[model samples]
Target: MDAIVALHQRVSQSRLTAPAPDSIQLDLLMRSAARAADHGNLQPWRFLIIEGEGLIRLGQLFARVAAAKKPDITQAELDRFTAMPLRAPMIIVAIAKCQPHPKVPEIEQVIAAGAATQNILTASFALGLGAIWRSGEMAYDDTVRQAMGLSNNESLKEQILGFIYIGTPDADARPARQINPKDFFSTWTGE
Candidate 1:
């Protein structure tokens, strides 16, 4: 698909199903992420690709975190948390590995990582795969960060930008909502 078309039409697919992207498509997705804009060439992004059993493990971790936060969490709530990662056949954990730099701030590094994730989303759409970028309280939890191998130490700050779920779109997937550029665009002029 044309880059412009993919950029314009890409929509989040929350109701994904099995049959994730094949190896070739996965390769393209990662490559697209590498093309994201980086300030000072910090290249401060890393991705953890999870599928099959790994998704189950991630779901379990999510449930654990939920239970820890709320000791009174019911069985059904725990089960719901455990099933979160099962919504898609694959998940890519997008991380921003921020490093100290004279010119580049931590926020820029995080934004770069977010752009990398956006690239993956657009590439997935172009490859005819469905994807959604998601993040909840678990994303900001320190325990979850450690579980994902991200350190919250003094020198280096690593953060989970989002969990990108990818797979085939369910048959009942909703259509993308129409957007008008005029509603969001504005011209700036010197007074």
Candidate 2:
């Protein structure tokens, strides 16, 4: 497939099915993720792949967090929270490791991580896999972060970037609304 078309077709997938991506596919995806552009060659991104029993554990953690925060949450809501990780056959937790570089600012390092994440999504799409990037309470919660062995210098406000779920689409994903380029473009003339 053409690179432009492959990139344009990449969409956030929320509905995925059984038979997670095989080891070979994962190897390719990881290699593709490593190809993301980085300033100063500081690869400040880390990916944690979670699936199988790990998904169940993640679901439980989400449920625990939800219940602790919202004691009055209904069983349905709890179930929903618990099942979030199970929605996809594979989930990659993307973390931004901030390593101070004299020549590279902290923000740039973080941006490199974000770029790596985009690469992961794009690669998944190119491989005919569905993908979605998600982050919420789990990414911010101290307890949840510890559960996943993620360290965040809260004082610095540095933490996990987000979660990228990848798998085969169980159902068709609704394409995002076409965006108008005009809304974001403006002529810049040095006067």
Candidate-wise lDDT, in order? 0.92, 0.84
Q: What is the TM-score of each candidate against the true structure?
A: 0.95, 0.90
Q: Which residue pairs in candidate 1 collide? A: none
What's the residue-level lDDT of 178 in candidate 2? 83
Once fitted onto the true fold, the runs of candidate 2 whose alpha carbons sit more than 4 angstroms away are 153-158, 173-176
Query: For candidate 2, lDDT tens digit of each residue in 1-191?
Result: 57797777678888888767888889988888788888888788888999999999999999999999998999999999899999898899988777667898889888888998998888887777888899987877888878877656632334688889889977776775688789999999988
Highest TM-score: give the candidate number: 1
Superposition error at 43 for model 1 (Å): 0.9
Residue-level lDDT for 60 in candidate 1: 96
Candidate 1's TM-score reads: 0.95
**Candidate 1: deviation at residue 135, Å?**
0.5
Task: Name the TM-score of candidate 2.
Answer: 0.90
